[model samples]
Target: MVNRTNRTQPLSGRGAGTREAIMTAAERLYAEHGLSNVSNRQIGEAAGQGNNTAVSYHFGSRATLVRTIMAKHGTHVGVIRMRYVKAAGDSTELRDWVRCLLRPVTEHHAALGVPSWHARFAVQVMTDPLMRTLVEDESLTRDSLCLTLQGLGRCLYDIVPPEIRPARAEMARHLITHTCAERERTMAEGLAEPGASWERTADALEDALVGLLAAPITRH
Candidate 1:
């Protein structure tokens, strides 16, 4: 699905710098505060723009800015997932496919170092009434993600009933995004567990997601 948001011409020089600064500031602010709670004027100010309309001038609306950030990070995560997908390679083991699903996002968070906000930012986007639709539109278009889903489906085709697959997949999504957000918040506040790390989180998520996807669906 093409992003229907308003597009700015490819920026150059200082214009590009300003746009990036605004996105960086917006991501951090939105991650810290709820999306609706943060204003474009505040985003511009945080970007160090003297012009209060900087966000509007550059990205137009909060939705467009959010899309831009999601697209940027989505591409990075797609790249990582593609590599993981290649490694999984026709493996029938459920855990291999589960790793393909969970590791890329956690690995990206690990690479972002401490004080990163994208995970938390994603939680807000995924949960927000207005922005939630954008997640499926943006994410479903990725080739790597498509392949991972296909592989996961093959693994679960016999075990998990078709009707409950969607619910389990949603559960997996919530588990990954919210847990990562919590970990990011913990680290940002200097309250992280001693030796706690994204790698460890990925390990745990892989185990939990495998169980989720492979569990039997009981009819009520």
Candidate 2:
């Protein structure tokens, strides 16, 4: 068997374009078949390359490729979330922070025309411990959302106890993840149903998120 780790044969001209094509194809395939099920060869084939080398040349490893796709997209998302946090004007209220954290993701899904595959991909990342670890290690940074989350925790600390802040953050993260998953499922169902609109779904989701995050914080 060919060494799957080897780089794809380099294109003679338009190397950058070829690399981008490979990345795009890999992202789509990974979203469809999942990280575990998809192989480098398959990605190359989808990218219009002759063999698996393209994936290796551009990304070095399967893990890196997945991380790259997420970072390229997720970093932009992080920026949007950070902007919302900045706009909150130092309130640091738990509900406000929660809304800021969630708004960007939900808006992105709404704006991008949520594909059915995105939900499945997100669900896999949410539940898989190894994948989560990889995400933290390779995709996230200290100054990124992780720091922003810590800041949010400090803001919430005024209301919730120190020992429990970690737990609360975890709970909040799960809540957001589940909400997104549910939104995707709703979208999938709505596509089959008559008169389904993303705008309606986004409005309802925003309302539900505010209620979900607000109730707990207000109770404290």
Which candidate wins on lDDT? Answer: 1
Question: Model 2, 1-220: lDDT tens per residue?
Answer: 6444534444456776777777777766665566788888988898899865777877678766666666656776787777876777567565566556667777666665745445456666657687778776754573446655765666656656666566655666676677666766666656435655544554565566445533454344
Cα lDDT of candidate 1 equals: 0.89
* lDDT for each residue of candidate 1 in 131-195, tens digit (9 for 90 to 100): 98976787999999999999998988888878889998989999999999999999999999899
List the pairs of residues colliding in candidate 2.
Answer: 7-53, 7-57, 8-53, 8-54
* Global Cα lDDT for candidate 2: 0.64
Name the weakest run of 10 consecutive residues (lDDT summed) in model 1: 1-10
Model 1 alpha-carbon miss at residue 29, Å? 0.8
- Candidate 1 colliding pairs: none
Off by over 4 Å in 1: 1-5
TM-score top scorer: 1
**lDDT of each prediction vs. the true structure?**
0.89, 0.64
Model 1, 160: alpha-carbon shift in Å?
0.7
Q: What are the RMSDs of all candidates, in order?
A: 3.1, 4.7
